[model samples]
Target chain A: MYQFNLHAILGYFGQLPSSILVTLEITLIALGASTLLALPIAKARMSGSRVAALLARAYVELFRNIPLLVLLYVYYFGLAQSGLHLSNFWATILALTTNAAAYGSEIIRAGYSAVPTGQREAARSLGLRPAHIELFVVLPQVVRVILPPFANHCIGVLIGSSIAAVIGVADLSDWMLATGSEAFRYMESFLVAAVIYIGLCQGVAAAMAALDRRSRRGAY
Target chain B: MFATGSVWDYWRVFVNGLVLTVELSFIALVLGFVLGMVIGLGRTYGPHPVRLACLVFTESFRSIPPLLLFFGAFYGLSYTTGVTLSPFQASVIAMVLEASAFISEVVRAAFRSVDRGQWDAARALGLRFWPALRTIIGPQAIRVLIPPTIGVYVAVLKDSSFASIVGLVELTRAGLLVRETVGDSLTVFLLLSGIYFVINFTISSGALALERRFRFAH
Candidate 1:
């Protein structure tokens, strides 16, 4: 019976940067795209129009509830059949963005809701336009209120990027799988991958903590 | 379009997949809760090294994608140790590991939110550590823990779909199979999404109701 080889796994760390970079790229792009998408949906959610509200609600519920892997497959394969071929990178990005946008919209909407209605009314009493009120008054406070949850969502998107491996995206997970297959040192490859993921996540947590501290200082 | 198979065909596969998913989630949920409590408490009061180790474990698991963990357990461990695990076992282990991290945070937060005065009062009353915890801390902590615990269960249910990549044949895999056979990807996916919607919606609503009941009771 062969015991797990710790030394060989340590060696796999040499190739870690490339895989980590791919995963980061996917995460950042998806996060940026999803945040942009979420803003409109969040606004629509708060809109008085029933159709807009319903559409926003359905989008959030559907995307948030569905498994991301299934969504990726449907986008990759199902879209392919319809003659709309997206690269694995794009497909995974699309899926992640759609999924993140749904959840992000809810988080942002909650933040918006937390903004006192009197503040908006107060802004209106000053003869501020609707757009001006939203932009100059509402959005800044909403951003502050939602910062922590938004940070959590970003962490979620970072982790969710690992699903990209299924659609053949050569992110950290895919690289780990490939490295394991090639080196015939599966445990080592995976251990390296795991360490990298852990490191990255810790970095994120630290960054979020620092941000939270900074935000609190500003608030005070 | 390929001919539509008998209703029994898709339904049977879906039922099988659903059962596996539920089983996977239940096992992970139960195991995760236990492990999470241990780690959570450890984080709260253990020595520095123990707290650091638990912090590392929790953050890493929380940050890394569940799919990566699943793949790592399924292929990486198998390759390294030459010990093959069943897909279900691999998926469950990965899910438990991931769930434990989040659960630990939930539990740790619950523990912290309990007033320090309660502990002081318990000690003042001459109650010992374990007894004070059982009679005072545990009950109050449970109220804070239950809602987020339900949220984690729903998250696990949704995450179990990632098991399909390693061939566990869960709900998502069943959808893929239907798509492959019927050549109607959209229809299959839509149906699959509906199933997930129903399951998650029910869980969330049930959790909210329970939360409300608990709030009133308190």
Candidate 2:
């Protein structure tokens, strides 16, 4: 009979604190960098210039389609050949940022779209400069409306951070893989790893749900 | 570059890898869709235990990265069961299991998104439970289901790359082979990424077109 050993599984958590801290660091950095990149990409996507829109559209389509693993490999291996060598952490961060920016641009673009045409017109009617109108009026509402989806995307970033393991980053998944391999306790290590992921993802989802409810309450 | 292989020299290996990739993806898609439909329905309509099981399955798979699942299924199953599987079989099984969990959520949401009035009307018509679902609920639910279901296909395609870690000789593996042979890592990988981009782009656009047509038709 196959027995489930609870203590062995519980022992895996001895490594959890450090692994989770690394995972959280990756998620936060990736989300922040991606959001910064996404702002301009989203703006360009919604730009009046057809050329700008086309470039942004191509970028999103290209990056969003390719798997993050492939992108990671390309950055880690491909870029290295071109004399732009990056350490595993830098490579992972770059790939995650690139992937997140592509998706976030679309989310933010949808946010931009959600800001009603009337509001833009109202801002324009007030003789406010384009920059001022976007900065003061349209941008705020876009952020507000996009918060729920943005929260969901952040959750996505958190999950997507697991791909960092491929490039040899010592995130949670990498730790699980390493420990499992070393101990030859594949089932216990993997089950524990899966639980950690489930817990983290559920935490993210719960937080996002609360934010969504709060935003809904405040929405006009 | 250390060793050189002509494009023609590697074409056979590349084509073989492509075929295997396509086969793995198709198998995973069909099995995952069926499994997803069952679990999706169960989560929506099954009794408490069934629903909870489905929920646990979905969350467990959804949270863990596909790579971990691939590794776990390959080694963990072998370790626990003494029933060994070939790398290819293990890859397919792992991908299908992971894909099914995600597809289940999409399908369940699609089911729920259909109006409650549809169910009420079906019940009032005196049709039995199975017939009510088959005749009324299934058709409407499928129409709403197509877009997200296609989205799942795109997801599964991208996920197939993870199987390469277990030596599945897919597109990514093919690129790795080229890297090993030609020693030009950049060109080979860039080409592989382009291939993946094209495949995913085609699927995504096809799905989008179908979704648009469905919306217009309805």
Q: What is model 1's native contact fraction?
A: 0.64
Q: Write model 2 residue lDDT over B74-110, tens digit each, in one string.
A: 8877777878877788898888898899889988988
Quote the lDDT for A55 in model 1: 95
TM-score of each: 0.91, 0.94
Q: Taking the tens digit of each residue's C-alpha lDDT, what string does model 2 give over A59-150?
A: 99999988888898899999999999999988888989999999999999998888889998998998999999989998778877888778
True contacts kept of 2: 0.71
Task: List, residue by residue over A47-76, the lDDT tens digit for candidate 1.
Answer: 999999999998987887788877887788
Indicate which candidate wins on TM-score.
2
TM-score for candidate 2, please give it.
0.94
